[model samples]
Target: MIYYQWGYYLTKQQILDLYKTWGGKFGRFNPHDLTDIFHARRSIFHYLMPGPVRVWIAGNDAGDGVLFFVGKPNCPIRESVEPDLAERCLAMFGGPPCPFTLVPNTGGEAYIMKRKGKLYKMDLIQFMQSDTKGDQYPLSLDEILPEQMHLLGL
Candidate 1:
């Protein structure tokens, strides 16, 4: 099955570094140290599998991002999602149907939300850096913009 996993706050350099370290073989989507927020809870499944893996990453003009991981069929990391989980993610982020939209942070939590024609993200880093919270978390799409010009080298 195909597991579509999404991520945020990661730079292209970091991904390339991981790709090189892993010898182009995809493995667990371990959260990065700099990952201030955005949690993909399903990532736990990745630890249960071991094999050659494929991973794809994407991001918006902001620093927010997405990742697509295809695991071996019947494996723990393979595509497996529950309707209830999807519902909770959608309700919290308020976007179109997504396979995964959670991102991890330091101590707190954060997520991405879309409204009108714009896309915005909330992250714990923002809170620490700017002392923002709740509705304020969704207020700054510009707050978390990355200095990197590209994402996942694309």
Candidate 2:
């Protein structure tokens, strides 16, 4: 399984700033270590940085303003690691914490979301279908299951 988190609303400069800061502090391989093919990809920039665990931070030059963290495959990001990372990211980016997940090959993957400083888990597919805009805050696993059960009620 691979763990990841997504964040939005950053300029290309901000992304580069993050890469530099993280690379200097924790990167096992620096930006210069990336292959030419990776550098040639103009839309996205990524660097592999290893702290307590390995992670890749990436962003795009497109106006979408998206940045993401990808943990190395088969390595689960520790619980302590994510909150610390998210806190720092929030301090820098000034937005809601994005969803974090351990994506599995089987179905029913759960996404960890933060609302009002409390964390909640929701099924990945349900979150995508209903909360892509994040209107459904403070959601709970029980809430999702019951709604589906109601739909199937006859």
Candidate 3:
């Protein structure tokens, strides 16, 4: 089964303060969104982040750890924090070009792929491989894991 860790750091009150001050660079800031934005964004992206506060899990790629502070209402760090992290997060999980697109065929079933007018129904790595060198390789049941399939809502 596909398992992932989800977590959060700061308290709801702290997140609200950050949203009130720096959420614009996090993307947008609406007074009504002090509670909704983080969860809504997580749902759309399918990333189970550990926070409405500050923390990272499967999807955070900044490499440099993220640290959030309960700064004064309009501190310089607060202004810079979300935007910089937004750019970093976007570039890491997001891909080249859009910096926020679903990178195709990454460690999961791609279903189908298009290339040069032909369709690739298997993973490119699997397709390019040949058994000419050996034939004793064991098979994996990755193709029919029921729990994994259920995750796709199939």
Highest lDDT: give the candidate number.
Answer: 2
Candidate 2 wrongly placed segments (more than 4 Å): 1-4, 16-66, 70-82, 100-154
lDDT of each: 0.33, 0.35, 0.28
lDDT per residue as tens, model 3, 13-131: 34334444432233233334422334323232222122122222111221211112111122243342355444443443342111011235366422232233543232211211111
Q: Write the per-residue lDDT of candidate 1 for residues 1-154, one digit (tens) a residue.
A: 3322332233444443434343432223343522322222113113212322222234445553333222222333223334443344334334333223334442323445333455555442322111112122232333233543242343
- As for lDDT, the candidate ahead, 1 or 3, is 1
- Model 3 global lDDT (CA atoms, 0 to 1): 0.28
Better of 1 and 3 by TM-score: 1
Deviation from native of the Cα of residue 45 in model 3, angstroms: 9.1
TM-score of each: 0.23, 0.25, 0.18
lDDT of 2 at 101: 54
Residue ranges of candidate 3 with Cα displaced over 4 Å? 1-8, 23-154
After superposition, candidate 1 runs with Cα above 4 Å error = 1-10, 24-57, 61-66, 69-154
Give all candidate RMSDs, comma-separated.
17.2, 20.0, 21.6
Judge candidate 2 at residue 9 and give its lDDT. Answer: 26
